[model samples]
Target: MCRWLAYSGTPLLLDTILYRPKHSLIDQSLHARMGVETTNGDGFGIGWYAPESGSDTPAILRDIGPAWNNRNLREIAQHVKSHLLFAHIRASTGTAVQQTNCHPFRHGRWMWMHNGSVKGFHEMRRELSLAVDPGLFLDIEGTTDSEVMFFLAMTLGLEEDPPQAVAKMVGLLERTGREHGIAAPVQMTVAVTDGTTVWAFRYASEGGARSLYYSTKVDSLRAQHPDATYLQELSEDTRLIVSEPLGDLPGAWNEVPEHSYGIVHGGHDSLHEFAPIMP
Candidate 1:
C-alpha cells in the first residue's frame, strides 16, 4: 500500500501540505501511521493544475526515488502553488519501481492516484488491459493496476460520470476476478481530479477497504479549534482528502465510510454510497 493526499481550496505552496504539517505526506513517506507499510519509499509523484496558465492539463512531477530525500521534489514543492493538487508516495505492491509507475497518473485535464492494489493483477493483467478502450489504451505509459483502472474508468465514461465510470471499472474487475478464480480482487482508495473538482472513492471487493479520511469543514474546524489561527487563513471551502490525517488535531478528520465515494466540488461537497455495476 501507499499514502496519498488531494487538496482543493485556497492556493498555497505545495510545501504547506506536503511537508509543513505535523504528519505531512513527506513524513508519511518515512513513517506512515495508518498504511499497511510504515514506510512508502519506492517512488513519489505530484500533480497540480495551474489555472492561471490557461491550460486545462495539469503539471506533473514524478521520480522513481524516495520522496523524503528527493531534493528536486523539495525544491519544486517550495516554489509551486495551486488550488487543486495531488501528491502520492509509492510502495509498489509488485510492479517495477519506475517513474512511469508512480501514482497521480494524468490524462488530459484529469489526474488519478490510488493507494491499494487490484488483487491478483498479474494473473489478470492481460484480460484487464485489453478491456481499456483501444484509443486510450495506446496512451497508457505505465504498467500498474492503478493506471489500468484510470483508463478503464475513462473507457467507461469518466468525463461524463466519474462515479458511474469508476463503478463500472470496479465491476469489470470483480467480474473478471471471479472468472479467474480469485476472490475479493479489488481493493482501492482512489482520488481523481479534473483540475476543477475532486472525486474520491473507498471500497474493496471483500468489504475491508484501506483507510481514507477527509478534513472537517473549515467553518466547523474554526468553531472547534478557536485558537488555531491557521483555520482563519483558509477559505471556508478548503478541503483535504488523504490516506490519513496530516495531524492529530481534534475533530480535524473524518474517515470516509466503507464502500462509498465522496466529491469535493468548490463548496458543494457530497458523499454517496458506491456500488460497482457490470460494464
Candidate 2:
C-alpha cells in the first residue's frame, strides 16, 4: 500500500500540503492511519505539469527514501509550483525498494500512481504481461504489479478511452486470478492524468477498496464560512484528491464512493459508476 494525492485547478507550491497540513503526505509516511501498514518509508515520488513552460507533459522526481527527511524533496517543494500535481509515499507490497519502482510512472503525456496490491501477483504476472501489447511490454521498468497494470491499460487502449481500458484491465486481472484460483486479485485506488485532465478511481476485486477523497469546492465553503482564512487563499478552481485528508477541515472533504471513478478538469467534476469490462 501507499499514500498519494492529486491536485488541479490552481498553481500552488508543493509544500502547501506535502508538508504543511496536519495529516499531510509526509505525516502519513510515518503515521498512516488508514493504510494496511502505518509506515510508507520505502520511497516517494512527485509529478507535476507546468503550463508556463509550454509543455503538456508532466515532469517527475522519484527517490528510494523516506519523504519526510529528503532535503532534495524539501527544496523542490519550496521552489516548484504547479496547477496539477501528484505526490506519493510508498509502502512496498513484495517489490524491491528502488527509484525505478517508485510511482507516478509516466509514458509521454500520461502519468499514473496506484495504492494497493494484486493478491497473487507473482503467480499471474507472466500471463497478464503477455496480454499487454508487444510494443508496450518492453516499456516495463519495475517489478511491481502496479507498473504491470499501467502497461496493461495502455495495451487495452488507454489513450483513446481511459475508463474502458482500465475496466478491461481489471476484468482481465480478475479472470486471470480466477483461472489461477486466487480470489480478490486486485485492490487499488488510482490516479492518472494527461496534463489537461485527471481521472481517479477506487475499487477492489472483492470490494472493500482503499480510502480516497476529494476536497469540497472551496468557493462553496468560503461562502458558508466567510471569514475562514484558508478558504480565502484558494482559487475557486483549486482541487485536491487525496488518500487521506490533508487536515481536519470541516465540510472540506468527501469520500469517493466504492466502485466509482471521478474526472476533474477545468471547473467541471464528474463522477461515474465503474464496473469491470466483462469479456
Candidate 3:
C-alpha cells in the first residue's frame, strides 16, 4: 500500500501542502494512521504542472529514498510552486524499491498515483501487461502494478474519458483476476490529473476499498473557522483530495463514498457512483 494527495486550485508552494499539516504526508511516511502499513519508506515522488511553462507536461521529482529524510525533497518543496500537484509515498507490496517504481507516474500532460494493489499481481502481470496498447507498452518503465494500471487506463481511453477508461481498466483487472482464480482482484484509491482537472476514484473488487478523502468546499471551511487566516488566503476553488485528512479540522474533510469517483476542478466538483464495465 501507499499514501498520496492531489491538489488543484490556486498555485501554492509544495511545502504548504506536503509538510505544513500536523499529520503531513511526510509524517505519514513514518507514522501512517490509516494505511495498511505504518511506514511507507520505500520511495516517494511529486509531480506538478507549471502553467507558466506554456506546456501541459508536468515536472516530476522522484527518488528511491524515504521522503521524510530526503533533503532534495525538502529543498524543492520550498522553492517550487504549482497550481496542481501530486505527492506519493510508497510501501512496496513486492516490487523493487527503485526510483522508477515510485508513484505519481507521469505521461505527457497527465499524471497519476495509486494507494492500493492488484491482488496477486505477479500471477496476473502478463495478462495485464499484454492488455496495454502496443504503442504505450514500450513506455512502461516500472514493474509496479500501479504504473501498469495507469497505462491500462490510458490504453482504454484515459486521454479522452478518464472515468470510463478507469472503469474499463478495473473491469479488465477483475476479469483477468477471475481467470487466474483470485477472488478479490482490485483495490485502489487513485488520482489522475491532466494539468487542469483531477479525477479521483475509490473502488475494490471485494468491498473494503482503501480510505480516501477530499477537502470540504473552501467557502464552507471559511464559515466553520472564520478566524483561521489560512482559509482566507486560499481561493474559493482551492481543493485537496488525499488518502487521509491532513488535519482534524471539523467539517474540513469528507470521506469519498466507496465504489465511487470524484472530479475536482475550480469549484465545479462532482462525485458519482463508479462501476466497472468490460473493456
Q: After superposition, how far is residue 213 of candidate 1 from its true place, in Å?
A: 0.3
Q: Who is ahead in TM-score, 1 or 2?
A: 1
What are the Cα lDDT values of the candidates? Answer: 0.95, 0.92, 0.94
User: Per-residue lDDT of 35-96 in model 3, one digit per residue for the tens?
Assistant: 99999999999999997888879999999999999999999999999889899999999999
In candidate 3, clashing pairs total 0
Error of 2 at 252 (Å): 0.5
- Please write out the lDDT profile of model 2 over residues 62-127, one tens digit for every residue: 999999899999999999998899999999999899999999999989999999999999999898
Per candidate, the number of residue pairs that clash is 0, 0, 0
TM-score (all chains, Cα) for each model: 0.99, 0.98, 0.99
As a TM-score, model 3 comes out at: 0.99
Return the clash pairs for model 2, or none. Answer: none
